[model samples]
Target: MTYPRSLLRAAVLAGMTVVVLVQFAAQLVLMVPGVLLGMVFLLPPPIHAGRVLVSRWRRMFANWTGRTVPVPYEPPPPPPEPDEEGLYRHESTLYKSPRFPAFFHRLDWLMKDPATKRDLSWAFWFPVLGLLPLALAAGPLLLALWTWVWGPPWGLPGEPSSGAWWATAWTALWERPAWLAALSVPGLVALPWTVGAVARWSAWLLAPGVRRPPSAKRVEQTLLAWVRCAMLVACAAAEVVLLAVSLACFGLGFGLGLVFLIPVANSHFRWLANMRRQFAEWGGVRIPRPYTPQLRPELRPDGLYRVKNNLYKTETMATFNANWQWTWNDIASWRDLVWLAADPVVTVALVGAPVAAVVYGGWGLVFPWVWTELFDADWSAWYGAVAGHRTLGLLVGLALVAAGLAVPRPLLVAHAWWTALLLRPTKAAAAEAALRERVERLTQTRTDALDAQAAEVRRIERDLHDGAQARLIAVGLTLGAIERLMDTDPAAARKLVAQARETSATALTELRDLVRGIHPPVLSERGLGDAVRALALDTAAEVNVAGELPGRPPAPVESAAYFAVSELLANATRHGGAERIGIDLRHRDGVLRITVTDDGDGGANPSRGTGLRGIERRLGTFDGTLTIHSPPGGPTVATLELPCALSSPKTSTS
Candidate 1:
């Protein structure tokens, strides 16, 4: 049988999420075991099993949207380190536990997992959110069907509770043909459109979003942002309503405790925070300058609390009353408060009002007319009273519905632009932020470089300890034994000397391997070209190298490029399943560029692998870059570029 339609997929999913989604909000208490029990024993296993349940929903979303949702779970944190001889003072790696005197780590992945939180949000919102779009699409049809099937009670201005309303509705419809045209025609035609809208809604909320890059056109960006911002605004609206009701209780000389509950209800809700960030990003507003209030840490003994201003803030609160001066010094906070106050107005104007108008005007206008046509005692009298007006109403309603689809985009753009106008930082502020960000990046780059250097040193130490040094020690013992035996036993001495010779050769090989790992001797003597060619020769796949440098790159750049290409070649041969590979290296305009292409099983993601991430971090130290293009199915291309000059004439061989 063919797969079920997309229309039913969400509802089917709603049915399937028995424990995970159906009563998720109600059953959230179950997570206590999943989270708290992680400390006492191996609770992560069950927690991981929950990931299996979440994967089902991901599949459902993918099936509906035709886009694969990448699982967003973070890799497990590193296990505790052990000391010499695979023992520890008090530690345990998740993999090897019994070797150490370790206690259960109190911090559970369950409590901090982003995937789990996303799953929870999806579960809670799917059923509730799906209702709006589905209802919009199907609700009108159902209402029309209800009216056509079960008419209004008794008659116009008549009994609504009457049981015989359906019989009378049919009789009234038969007498008046205009009732069917005006009522049922528009809704039936609009069914496809409403259904599609609802589908997009579901896709946006449930499916992994196809996120747009920052450079996308402002209009398109705002259109998508509107969807996300609308959801956030809706949540904020709920909080507002609750807080209002709470405030009103105090006004009534009742429920005085509600006043105290306001902060508990209002503080640190991330929806508004998220919306603000979205506004700043999509609306093209520069990020606000950060304010650190004190030299001391922001955290308090009790909990996290950010001080709101720079230490010894000097800005005057000109409008501050003497009594309120203490609270009013920071104008940024007050500005944010104003934004909070005006949120409802902006939200309605930008999102809620326009949508309602279109939906109601196009599909909703027919309802009153349907009732009037079906229940009117004198159809001819009412019809004869208004003739062209009925046609006028039809034209207007159709226009409204048509405008509904087109106007929201323009409105969204305008709102974004306005937000940008209000929230955009001054040019001076932006320049400062830019400088600060650059400084931060450079600082991080330096740190990464140091870390890479430290790691390299440790690696070299490890190699010497395991390979060259051990082999040399063995060779020394073998030579010592041979010398001791030479005079005493001549026949046995010859065998000992032969073993010593073999040990010396093995030790020399180990030293060569260690040197190659540090920087290939070919790379130092012959430069990058022969080094890459030599690497290709070692791989099983057919490899070709082209292009020549005017001169060789600096030693560090050459070494980095060789290692990067080596990694790529290894990847292609092992994981990529390549049969053939091409390497093209050239130096142009003081920058050396290396391009590697492989015919292989593709779909390589640099973000997913440690090797690629490490390469990127390594390159970042020298302002180098790696760009990967590997579409699924076959063929992969990786481009590595380094900005540096070459040395004198370089030696090379294949």
Candidate 2:
């Protein structure tokens, strides 16, 4: 039963392999024309078809192996929507019809997805490897058929002998009929193993999320490092050309007065430097851009715009001059020029040398053997050979390749250090950059505070109008009704008075609740520590408060800290599924720090929750920061820090 089942599965896999081979051939045929002849429209269809085929195989293999294969492709882009003008936009151009934009979007989607390449690879390799299992399963049947039809070495009485040389030679080789039958048994026994092997190999490439074996991962890393080194070498060569062009442009702009070309060259080549800065991360260093902010022309009170000392009545001329001067005066611009001049020499020597050694060494190892042995060519002293000793050359080549591989990662780090030396901002420039960032953050926080203040005011007004004011109006009407009812009936007048009293009490409670929402009474009277304790009493979880401040924080800071803790507690209970929580408060080094830790299923993301973002904004008003460390399982800890002074302890007030 096992042997038959294995053969059945093998036959099905073999048929699938044929389909995969056809798909592979179709893709190769389309890819050539699509890439070379600009028929990109031909590319997506074959890739999409290949994905469908691969997806089916992935499911079958997963079912057979009882292991999951996650879908590795990114979600497709949303369909294009027309703007107010009823035109769809794709990149820079707008079109009346959605067809062109949709096509381009789909093309981008398919080409950019890594899974598509993996599918194409699977398509190519599966057909070649799939033949093994197919041959194993089918070999026994072929041998049986051959022996039955040819009647072993000697022809049967009724069987006609073949006169063909190949048939006669094949019949002569199989002397015994039993040997042919015996050969089929081993293939039948190996069928199941081959099938499992194919399933395992297919899953490795198809499942991107699957953890690779250590050896495979190490090899991939080594190859990727080599690729990165090669890319750096190529980029260094490109930078040399850019440096020459930049020098020429600077000469023309400054020396010959081609002022327009100056900004063009500066702006265009700046991206390459920025790319290199980004790539510097591979070397375990980060390089930030050093250019100053581009400020717009400020309109003066004298009815003119100022660019430097120069003033223009028209805005356009002033703006252009400002940009030109800004670029020209930036110290970073000169630093970039210097970097462009020096990068080629440094990068080529540091990064390129290893790659060159590897390439030359590989050539010496493989090509020399091929030329000397296969073609019987004379050995040359060039390459890795020494005095026509091919064996010596092979050994030298092997060592050189190993040496080349060993040094690329370290050399890459060295290259990054060199990049940082030229491209990173100077001390003064870094300070200015920090100041500019501080100003920007302050501006944003101010805007947020204003918006929040307006929203709070609107909320207060709505509550007053809809709750307290309406109840008070009702109380006044009831009192007036009582005035009328007193003369007619004393009993009804008494009842009306009682109803008005109850309504007034409810209104007062509503007003107090609204005030508490604005600034909690406990926070003002008892300070932040006692207020947070009062907050914890109302929460669902068992909360333990630890640590104490020596004195009270400023009212505003205390209020912000209280509310921030309240929000964290609420998040822990509501979303984090916390059962127990701990709150700690301290004033250390003039900074009030509050830590809230919760034992919960903790995966808190501030960006996703408005409660957290509101807490951040409220804290930001006082130059406070919220940092959370929430791993997936349990125990989320959120720390809130605010820089403020603490005053002497104040007496509790009613």
Candidate 3:
């Protein structure tokens, strides 16, 4: 059986996280120097540097949880402008002279920021909170490994009996040490749940979004309930047939029949359920599993009684006990037998007819000739030897040939409809399944958002490293050369200085462009509406704009919305093939809606290119929706809606 992906994720993440946790503990050592710097020198560069390292830790936490954390520290106020002589003096003065007021201000701002504290808290507690699930997922595999390698030679911890041979350990599991094989079953089942759960817990703490659309979720649940119904019916029908076989075998084979009645019936029921689940899945329905919570071994009366009885309790014997009620409770398995028995008879024909046609129609013609030639027998002997000699032999052969040519596509269609009838889930199950799917989707998009942010940061870094930073270094080198040449070659010094100035100016412009590419300054300074209007000013097409939110959204949402519009406008300009475009923005009832319409060639689809899909995926992170309505030969309209309220005490500006 395949393990659930959640368990695999939990196991892997937990292992890496354990190492992160150790590093996380080590990070607290930063506080010692941080406080030391805070007390002595107010404007300490080390303190800020330490925080930057901690921000990386915070990002790791966010990634595991599938939530993106925006860096909270404000960008340092722009450096003082140059004087008329083109000299920058404020950088020297801000830190050099007299009072430590600037230092105090910097320290105070770092200490006061809420985001800083959130990061610190997350670093310390995430390991504690996340480790339990991780352990659960990883524990079974570890135990199995121990048993497989060591338990065969020597029994576990206290057992005195010599362990079984390695050959019998797994294959002939019933003879000795069968529990080793048994251990693997629970291990596979335990691990797959933690992936989404960890993600949800992380999101809740970091950046919880809105609930899924109830209507859509409810429909999914309904579909799941129907699948359960199908499986139940199949299980019941299959069980009935198996039950009769079980009794018949028991009557004939006696004690040896124990294997038939239990294993045979169970295997058949399991197979039916598995098939139903697959069929339902093929029809785009997720079967809702019946949730069962187990009683803890330590707290359960059965465990306590066994302990009190010195582990010699005969009544605790698991098998060879009468428990018809236990069997009766397996409603799901039995219910599936019914569906299995009724599983669209047409499905068998749908699958079988073509196979028959291939087997006989393709291979049929040669069989008779081969038999006749090899044995030196005539057709009459091959056909009439089995049935008394008659003129009907040729007709029988023709009928057999005709049967192979049958193609029953209608049966295939009927089988599909039959599958659809049973696999649809109920409202509640659909809602629950929808939530699971949404959680998985939210986690994915959150990861994408984080990745996008990281990519942007890297782009900015590269621009500085290769472009602006390199330019600045060149300028500094030129300045040093000019300084040395000033007394010796005045004209050469002036010419070099002028080139350095130009280099500095170019680097500054590149820096500004990098910043704008990340999050436009216009979007922050003037709200999304005006920011978009500013964007349109540079576009080639004629554009009209309307509507505005009363206040700004969270920084991340605003940034995503701005880019979403930008992407749409770009698509319109490049591929839209139109002269005019319209933009509308409206915020009401805690949702921001943006509509972009272009009088262009209509047939626009996300599948045709990455741009539209990229916009949709970006908006999806904020519990947002993107709808595109474009028909051939006309106008195209795209609408984006995000579920976020504009109620922050201070408007967020990125």
Best model number under TM-score: 2
List ranges where model 1 is wrong by over 4 Å.
Answer: 1-274, 280-391, 485-491, 544-551, 582-609, 625-654
TM agreement with the true structure for every prediction? 0.55, 0.70, 0.41
- In the order shown, the candidates' Cα RMSDs to the true structure are 11.4, 8.9, 28.3
The CA-based lDDT of model 1 is what? 0.60
Give me the runs in candidate 3 sitting further than 4 Å from their true place. 1-432, 631-634, 648-654
lDDT score of model 3? 0.60
Model 3: per-residue Cα lDDT over 1-654, one tens digit each:
135556656665677567657656565565655577654453245446646655665575577555675555533322233332333332223334223433444454566545455545555676775675655645545555665666533442342232334433433443344454465565456544555565555544443222447986876655444344444345445646755665564465455645435434433455545555565554455565432121111223554323222332344432212222233344444444455455535344344554444344334434554454334345645443235432344345455445533433333344445654544444654676678788899898998688666766777788889999899899989989998999999999999988998999999999999889988898887778888999889889998998877888888899999999999888888877768999999998888999999998666655444567668778988889899987554589999999998854344554
Per-residue CA lDDT of model 1 for 502-583, tens digit only, reads: 8778878888888898988888888888889999899999999998777888888888899999999988888789999999
Candidate number of the best lDDT:
2
User: Model 1: number of clashes?
Assistant: 1
Global lDDT scores for all candidate models: 0.60, 0.81, 0.60
| Candidate 3 TM-score, C-alpha based | 0.41
Please count the clashing residue pairs in each candidate, in the order shown. 1, 0, 38
User: What is residue 234's positional error in candidate 1, in angstroms?
Assistant: 6.4
lDDT of 1 at 180: 45
Model 3 lDDT at residue 437: 80
lDDT of 1 at 156: 31
